[model samples]
Target: MSRLALAIPLLLLALSAHAEIVIGLVANRGVEETRLDWQPIADDLGQLLNQPARVVAVKNEAELLASFQRGEIDVLRGSSKVALSAVEGGKGEIFARLALTGRQTQYRSLLLVRRDGPASLDTLLAHRQQYRYASGNPDSTAGYLIPQYHAFVRNNVLPERFFRSVTVGNAEDNFRALVERRVDVAVSNTDDLPKLAEKYPRDYQQLRVLWQSPPFSYDPLVIRRELPAATRSRIASFFLDYGRNGPDATRAKEKLYWADQLDGFLPATNRQLREVTDLQLYDALFRLALMPELDTSQRQSREKLLYRRYDQLTALLGGAR
Candidate 1:
């Protein structure tokens, strides 16, 4: 009886260790594209963990958050802002950061305007209401937050109130709208610079960068904290070693598979998220300051909450490097 009891507990523990993993992805290039691009990686990860793994591709910030809230997602690989929220809301932690093959580990936000419509940033800003805008997901560091803070709010312009209209989508869609002349300005990023050149060469030529925000680290892989620490360490080791040295004879070249995304990953911690977090906090404070409709009492109360969260972020992550 005692032996059977011990074996039952062991069986339960082993089965729990192999719990199915749901990896969350943001379909930045559309759901099909995102899945096609990531399925190989997910398959490989499941192989390594010896566990069944699946992916859930989300199209926007809200969907991503909802998946995390429902406990349906066990992992994430996306924007730093999204990672920040994941680390907070999902009780997850950063495990690895994707290394861009030949590029800097950090990328900057880009504000693009049609070459013929608005000649320059100043022209767009000066005649803001005359032009429509296309932006990235609000939770995306490059798309909505950085440009809003750098070009709009700091200059006393609020996008929704200043532009003739503002539309939101992934970078590719927003760029498409820009090329089709549906929107006058689109916020893109350095990471997509090469992609723009290749996929939309003609349209790429017709577009010009209006502004660039400060640098931000690349997307990170965040996993829920309930995973075993040993498993997390093994996963980190897998990424850190995956793309280095050269292609393996047994597998296809990472360059061929991931394009610019997989140069291998650098093991990371939550500290790497601080820079974007700083922007997120300051952006809130600045936007609050610029809100025309915020009465003194509401402003004060919101400001108090924002600052409290700001302080908590600072305390938890330390100040940005």
Candidate 2:
């Protein structure tokens, strides 16, 4: 072969060998914080699979979906809502679910208000136009979706119509709003409550849970469905067996648990996410009812349809309360 021909093939081989396996982490924290938490897992996967692995911090669920569509992310870890959305969009499949230490595979969203505040679910409902509310991003499962469904479809109290104002932000922003008495109510999850309490004991001490949503499954670790079979198998094996065996098991367990607050990972299949999928549907209907462009009659129709769908999904999941 000619020297140019030989060089061309060799360069291609080197490029292929160095191709990075990008794992997308849903950003619940700052990019630096998320990268620090997930880098160990990426590094471990690189060693196990003998492939270059890196973690990409996705700013939000929308960005995560967009990245998946662009084929920028090979693996994903985030809320079950995000996972189900990716699967429904034909972009990804569930490969594993995190098992938190001393925590179930499920968690619940809590509606909170200051213990001494004049805000309670009842007071807010009574004084409809007087109370402000804060919630997480629209894509958040525990933060926005579940809480919206619980309030509107389940209780027939539309926040947009009832509350004085509604603001959407991340957990920290929402909690801070509530703590500073800027918002009358906020939504947070059980998993995050402990951390908040630990971080801000005084603010947390003044907070009280006004309501709790039905349990939701822990987020799933997903991989793009278009990835090679060998790559999928290798990634799955790493998650499934991580911290469970080998001489370095203890160190691996500590690293994963301390960094990500997960005990380990368990094998998961798409079928196991039916409830989450249903929740996503419920979230969509709830959001539709909140559209300001919708006429009163149109909004009512959407609310009625949402209530019916909620009942149907709850029946399938053995009730939401």
Best by TM-score: 1
The global C-alpha lDDT for each of the candidates, from Candidate 1 onward, is 0.77, 0.77
Per-residue lDDT of model 1, residues 139-257, tens digit only: 88778778888878778787998989999998888889998999988888987766767877887898888888877788888877877788777667666666563345226346324
Enumerate residue pairs that collide in model 1: none
TM-score of each: 0.89, 0.83
TM-score of 2: 0.83
For every candidate in turn, the CA RMSD to the true structure comes to: 2.6, 4.6
Model 2 per-residue lDDT tens digits across residues 261-291: 7788888877666766565666666568558
Q: Where is model 2 more than 4 Å wrong at Cα?
A: 1-14, 118-120, 282-321
Off by over 4 Å in 1: 1-8, 245-260, 291-298, 319-321
Tell me the deviation in Å of residue 317 in model 1. Answer: 0.9
